[model samples]
Target: MQKLRHSSLAIAFSLLFSLAVQAAERPNIVVIMVDDLGFSDLGCFGGEINTPNIDSLASGGLRFTSFYNCARCCPTRAALLTGLYPHQVGLMRNGNSLTRNGVTIAEALGAAGYQTAMSGKWHLSRTQALPDHQKQLDWLNHQSQPDRTFSPVDSYPINRGFQRHFGPIWGVVNYFDPFSLVDGETPVDEVPDDFYMTDAITQKSVEYIREMSKSEAPFFLYVAHTAPHWPLHAKPEDIAKYKETYRDGWHKLRNDRYQRQVEMGLIDPNTYPKPELQGQGDDWGALDEATRKHMSQLMSVHAAMVDCVDQGVGQIIDTLKETGELENTLILVLADNGASPERYLQPGFDRPNETRAGKPIQYEGLFTPGSETTWGYIGSYWASAGNTPFRYWKAQSFEGGAHTPMIAHWPAGLKTKPGSTTDQPGHVIDVLPTFLELAAAEYPQTFKQNKITPVEGLSLAPILSGQQRAGHPALFFEHEGGKAMIADGWKLVQPKQNGQWELYHLAQDRTETNNLAATEPERLAQMKRQWQAWFNRVKP
Candidate 1:
C-alpha cells in the first residue's frame, strides 16, 4: 500500500509540472490599434511627437519598417481581425458587416482557452440593417439617441467572442459624450462631465487587465483607439503644447520628418528619394495668416489626441507590471491606416455641429479649433507632411496610405535585439495568424456551424524570433477603385479604379518617385495579371 501511494503521488506531481509548463508557454496578447495614424507619427517611427510610452516598447522590442495596412479604416480592421482579405470577409467597403464566411481572431483564441476582450471603435458593421443612406438620415433625425436601437445585437463585440467589451458601436462619435457607448451588450447612456474617449478606453482596458490577471487562462485584449482622427477635439492643456508648432508649414515639416527617419535608420536615404507633393492643397507659404493659424491649431489638436493615446499606453504598461504580467505579455501597436486629409467646414449628421453638452460649434469663420464645441480637419498639406517621405493620403493604394509603423514587444517570447527594425514585408492580415501562433491556437476549418475561409496570412513567429524567413509570395490591396500588388520587390499600383498601372521597383524606389511602367512593360503586364487574379479570387 505504501509503494502504490508513492507511485500515485509521483504521477500527480508530473501532471502539475506539465500544466505549469504549458501555461508559461502561452503568452498573453495585447494588440493596440490606432485609427488614421500616419507612418511617421510615433517618436520611435521618426516623428517629433511625444510618445515616450510607445517609444519604450519599440526600444525594448522589434519594429517593422515595411508593415502594411489596407489603406482604409474598416478594411484594415477586418483584415487584422479575421486573417483574411477584407473582401473575403464581405468587407469590400465601409458600412459592410463582417460575414460568417470568416472566423475572427477572438473566436479562435477564445476556443483555445483565452479570455478575449475588446475596447474602442468597432467599425465592422453598420448600426442598422437599413441602407446606409437611411441610417445616415436616422442619425440626423435623432442626434441624441442614447441607445443604438437599430444596431443588430449579434454584430456587437459580446456576440463576436469577446467575453467583455466597452466602447462605441459606431465608427465616429463625440470625444466627450460619444454616441452608442456600450458595456458588453448594455448601452451606457450617460458619461461623466470629465469624460474623454481616449482616457475612458484606457480605464476600461486597465480594468479588464486587472480582472483577468487573477485567472489562470491567458487573455487576449484588443484596445482600438480612435484618436487623432477627424473632429479635432482635445483638452486645453494638451492642445497648448503645440499651439504654433506648425508655423514652419508642411513642406518644412515633411523634410524634417524625413531627415529624422534617415538619421534613425528607419529609412534609407539613397533608396527612398523624397517624393513630390501629389495631393491638391494650398502651399503652406501661400496661405493667408488667418488660414495658417487655423491649420496650425488643427495640427495641434491632432498632436494632442496622439499624446492622450500615449498616456493611456503608459497606464496600461503600469497595470501589466503591477499584475506581474508585463514580462510574459506580447504587445503589438499599429495603425488602422495612414493620416487622413478629410476636411469639413460645417458639421453634418456624420460630423456633428454641436458638442456633447449641446454647445453649438462651427468649422468655418473665426473660432478656436480643438475645443469641445469646435470641429476641424488637418487637410491635405499637413497630411502629406504626416506621411513624411511617402506620397498621397488615406483611401488610396499608395504607400502613404497603406504603409504603417508596427511595433512588437515580448520580453519572454521574442529573441531579437531591442530597437531593431525588420524590413520583412508584412500586412494587417498577418496579425491574426501571429496571435494564433504565439498562443498555440489552431485555425478551425469551420466555426459556429458555418464554413469559414482559410487564413490568408503567414505566421510572423519565425520573423519575430530573429530567424531569416521568406515572407508572403504576393500581397494585394484594393479600396473603392484603387488597387496595388507587391511581389518580389516589384510593386504595381493604380491611383484610381480602372486607372493606368504604374510600376516601381520597390527595392530601388520605395518612395515611388521614379515610375518604371513604360520601361518595364513585361514585368508590369505579369504583375497586372496577378493582381486581377487575386481580385477575382477574393472579391465579395
Candidate 2:
C-alpha cells in the first residue's frame, strides 16, 4: 500500500509539470489591428505621429517592412481572422458575412484549450443598410432605428467562438455613438457623453485581458480598432496636439516621411526612389489659405485618432504588465488597410444628418472638422502622402493600398534582436496560422458541422525565430477586379478591374514605377495566368 501511494504521487507530480510546461509554451496572442492606417503613420515606421506604445513594440521586438493587407477593411479583417484569402472566406468585397466555412483563429485556439475574446470592430458580419437613404442615415445616426439589427444573430463575434465581444458590427460608424455597437449579442443603446470609440474599444480590451488573466489558460484577444478611418471624427484635446503638424502640406510632409524612412534603413533611396507625388502636382504652396487650413485640420483629426489608439496601446501594455503576462504574451500591432482617400463630399447613406444631440452633421459651407457636428476625410492627396513613398491609396492593388506596418513583440519566445527589422514579406492571412502555431492548435478540416477551406497562409514563426524560412512561392490578391501577386521579389499589379497589368522586380523597385511588362513580356504573361488561376480557384 505504501509503495503504490508513492508511485501515484510521483505520477501526479510529473503530470502537473507537463501541463505547466505546455501552458508556458503557449503564448497569449493579442492582435491589435487599426483601420485605414498608412504604412508610415507610426513613429516606428518613419512617420512623425506620436505612437510611442506601438513604437515600443517595434523597439523591443521586430518590424516587418514588407507586410501586406487586403487593401480594404472587411476583406482584410476576414483574411486575418481566418488563415484564408478574403475571397475564400466569402468577403471578396464589402457588406458580406465571414463564411461559416472559414475557421477563425479564436475558434481554433479555443478548441485547443485557450480563452478567446474580442473587442472593437467586428465587421466580419454583413451590415444590413436600409435602402431608403434617409432611413439609413437615421439608422446610422441611431435616431430612428431603435431595434435595427446590423447583422445576423449567428454572425456576431460571440456566436463565432469569442466568449466576450464588444464593438460595432458595421464598417463605417459615427465614433461618438456608433451605429451598430453591441455588447456580445445585445445592442449598446446608450453611450456616455464622453464616449470615444478608440478609448471604449481599448477599455473593453483591457477589461477582457484582466479578467482572462485570472484563468490558467492562455487567451486570444483581437483589438480591432476603428480609429483613423473617416468621418474624420476625433476628440478636441487629441486633435489640438497635431493641429499645425500638416500645415507644411502633403508634398513636404511626404518627402519628410520618406527621408525618415531612408534614415531608418526601412527604405533605400537609390533602389526605391520616392514615386513622384502620387496625387500629381499637389503643390501646397499654390493652395488658398482656407483650403490649406482645412487640409491641415483634417490631418490633425486623423493624427489625433491615431494618437488615441496609441494611448489605448499604452493601457493594454499596462494591463498585461499588471497581470504578469507581459513577457509571455505575444503582442502584434498592424493596420487593416492603407490610408483611405475616401472624401465624403456628398453625405449620403451611413452619413448622419444630425448628431445624437440634434445638431446637423455638417460637410458643407463652414464648420470645423473633428467634431461631432462635422464630417470630413483625409482625401487622396493627403492619403498619397499618408502612404508615403508608395503609389495610390486604399481600395487599389498598388503598393500603397495593400502595404501595412506590422510589429511583433514576444519577450519570452521572440529570438530576433530588439529594434531589428526584417524585409521578409508577410500577409494578413498569415496572422491566423501564426497564432495557431504559437498556441499548438490545429486548423480543422471541418468546424462546427461546416467544411473549412484549407488555410492559405504560411506560419510566420520561422521569421520570429530569426530563421530564413521559406516564403510563399506566390501570394495572391484580388478584390473587386483589382488584383496583385507578389512572388519571389516580383510583383504584378492591376489597379483597375480588367485594367492593364503592371509588373516590377520588387527587390529592385518596390514603388511599382518601372513597369517591366513592356520589357519582360513572358514573365508578365505567366504571372497573369497564375493570378487568373488563383482567382478561379478561390471563387466561391
TM-score of each prediction: 0.93, 0.94
lDDT of each: 0.85, 0.87
After the best TM-score superposition of candidate 1, give how far the Cα of residue 208 lies from its true spot, in angstroms: 0.6
Candidate 2: give the clashing pairs: none
User: Candidate 1 has what TM-score?
Assistant: 0.93
lDDT score at residue 228, model 2, on the 0-100 scale? 91
Q: Please list the Cα RMSD from the true structure of every candidate, rounded to 1 decimal place.
A: 7.6, 7.3
Q: Give the best candidate by lDDT.
A: 2
lDDT of 2 by residue, 1-540 (tens): 865664555445434433543676688999999999988899998899999999998999999989999999999999999989989888998988899889999899999999999999988887766778887777766678645577897999999889999998888788888878899999998999889899999999999999999999999999999999998899999999997899988988899999999999988988787897766345677878888898889998999999999999999999999999999999999988889988666666667788777778878654579877888888888899999879988898889999999999999988899999998888999898878777767899999999999889877877787766556778888878789999878999997645988999988998888988899999999999999999999988
For candidate 2, the 10 contiguous residues with the lowest summed lDDT are 12-21
- Scored against the true structure, residue 202 in model 1 reaches a CA lDDT of 97
Cα RMSD of predicted structure 2: 7.3
* lDDT against true structure, model 2: 0.87
